[model samples]
Target chain A: MAKRAAFDIPDGAYVNLGIGIPELVAKYVPEGREVVYHTENGLLGMGPSPADGEGDPELINAGKRQITAVPGASYFHHADSFVMIRGGHIDICVLGAMQVSETGDLANWSTGSPDAIPAVGGAMDLVAGANAIRVVTQHCTRDGQPKLVEACSYPLTGAGVVKRVYTDLAVVDISGDGFQLVELAPGIDFEHVRDLTAAELRPLPN
Target chain B: MIDKELPTAAEAVADVFDGATVMIGGFGEAGSPIELIHALIDQGASGLTVVNNNAGSGEVGLAALLKSGRVSKLICSYPRTAGSRVFPDLYRSGRIELELVPQGTLSERIRAGGAGIPAFFTPTAVGTPLQDGKETRTFDGRDYVMEHGLTADFALVKCSRADRHGNLVYNKTARNFGPVMATAATTTIVQASEIVDIGVLDPEAVVTPGIFVSRVVGVAEPALESELVARGVSYP
Candidate 1:
């Protein structure tokens, strides 16, 4: 799913990847394209994880994992770093989602369970501020429940913010009408993908 | 002599009073002033309101401070992180109150507080649960939620280098929230790895100017929170 999402990113995009599968998109950006990675914790031109013994605790990503900086990387304070986000300077933001509504609403931050500790982080800012927002996730939950739904039951991170979704079954675009199929993963049929989606899935256009 | 330098972390935080709103700068453990926080822990001030990006990881640094039960309220973006049991436990038990702000909004609030802006409108959390009960207005047909500037009684920050005058330079991504938090606090205390001479630091490269900072403590070799947590070390 990550590799498929990477294929859609235009060259020279300033991209912010949310933790989890979205983080892997940087590694598969088709070699020739130069996409600068932005970590909302205040590093631009972020590099991959450092060697086992060379990790610096202070030089880490948004996920709080040790990461290296590219040679041209620049560090700024949180305000300026977020300016790149809230000011809409970020070209693309790919995030992991718990649920996405047919209207492009994103619900990745909270499950709304009273027992769960609600943590928002930068997910709302990324969805609202980035020029384009994409989500990469599994088509269904581990228990086989569809994540693409008519309406999000969880607390939303942002409303009507997602542009596209890359899942294990298909690549779907959130349009004014609803979920429009962009492309299917190899050998995945339209009916099979639609069966797993609680929302209406429009087949690919001719 | 314009010496803002202090000899110990305990001395730096000695004057912090109970019920003070303090901003502890860091995104996770990076740029976290652990020594200052530890000192604050030992200082034993209670009913404190603490601000940071994350609550803290493991039973060290901010987590350790939270575990000590000194902080009564936390203002932050994300509190549930890997190995972050302290804040969650306190929050669930209704011992600690949490004001969960979105990351960018939190940063802007600190920046605005420092810059003397009382309140600002942002489009970040509009139409979400975070926008509930906040003042909302539309400008140019786009909706926004109003957020107030957040100031603090004190700010605890960590930096890579500092001068006697309190000018600071941070290392890598560890610079998060330190500069803005320094400005947002009445007394911004800093812990630096090296305290250099004034003018030794390039004027153009200084991340935080001296006027915002109140005191500086030198921790030539600061303890890494990850290692401390790895060793199962908890604070006193």
Candidate 2:
């Protein structure tokens, strides 16, 4: 499934996975691939998120939420950490988004929700500096609303920062013209997924 | 300029030009710099490039700057508090100015900046586009290359105490970026929870050498406000 491919992270990928859905990649990354996880608090080579009490008090993900560490993990001063990210040391960054425009404009940071809590940590650097930006999210928000829109009614996180998007139902690649449907979940129709999205989609050539 | 209350906070902040670079000290509510941040906010500054650990709750310290439209660009480790609530978006439709840095590298920049080194190399990003357009070499059968150090025009750091000479000490987790940011900024300004005499602070307890700090503004921060409101939970 295209959704599953998102977790098929390539080997030796120095990836920074965002919170929520993007965090799931740590659990199901294809075996035999040396995928390194980076957290903003200064940890790399992280393992899967531990079962509640199993997490180390010090180790965490990019979100600062408790996580697990694989062997050969190293810690360092965090100020130096940004130097690495801005210096473009990361191969891929998996982020979540509120909206992905037809032309690939991204709005993931601040939603239009008035009560939304305010913050912006290292997302700015990740979007601008990372080699490739992969977005992981449900096709539509939990409210049964389409997140892929003509324009983001919320706020923009990066301008065309997204290279590709993997949802629970489909795989989309944003390019010069608009979002191109690359793949879809097995048994899921292209129209249904396209219907769930407000943006226009062109089917990938067979 | 000289008053019992408003220390040289704003004037010292004057050199922080539009789009000036900065390294801040804070992690969530755990380690925010209260006075120095307020001094910058109160002065109505705009288009700052803040490099720090996190983008705390929007109404919290630096979050207020985002609301004030002063921060045009932000470079930090954790740009938003996760799984809690999304932050107040601060950019236009086509452009996103916030830049995310891996947490470890962010701290190292401050460490390197304060250490007076222009740049040092690390193999952390080898074989990826992250190594694009930079000097690289094979060292000891591995790739270890140079990553430049970051120094800001101004550093807004927080400390637990300060002496007349600007020597500072941090309490608990608040030390997260204070010591490093002091050295990372050309003109480092500090906000202390309390001001003691020069001889009061222990020489060993001074985390930031007074030589790196330019001015000290004294103020205490409020305790963490942990009122978590679950989203989409209907009132029954």
Predicted structure with the largest TM-score when compared to the true one: 1
Question: Per-residue lDDT tens digits of candidate 1, residues B104-202?
Answer: 999999999999999999999998999989999999999999999999999999999999999999998899999999999999999999999888999
Worst 10-residue lDDT window, candidate 1 chain A = A26-35
lDDT of 2 by residue, A1-206 (tens): 22374465788888888877787777677768788888755567777767977754334455545566678976543454565576789888888888888867677666656454334456656675678888888889888999888777765655666778888889988888888998887789998988888978888777
Q: For candidate 1, lDDT tens digit of each residue in A71-169?
A: 888999999999999999999999999999999999998889999998999999999899999999999999999999999999999999999999999
Q: Could you tell me the lDDT of residue B209 within candidate 2?
A: 73
Cα lDDT tens digits, model 2, B106-225, are 666568877888887665434333345779887787565567788898888766788767888765434567777888788788777788876798896676778888777777643331
Per-model TM against the reference: 0.99, 0.57
* Predictions in order: chain A TM-score: 0.98, 0.90
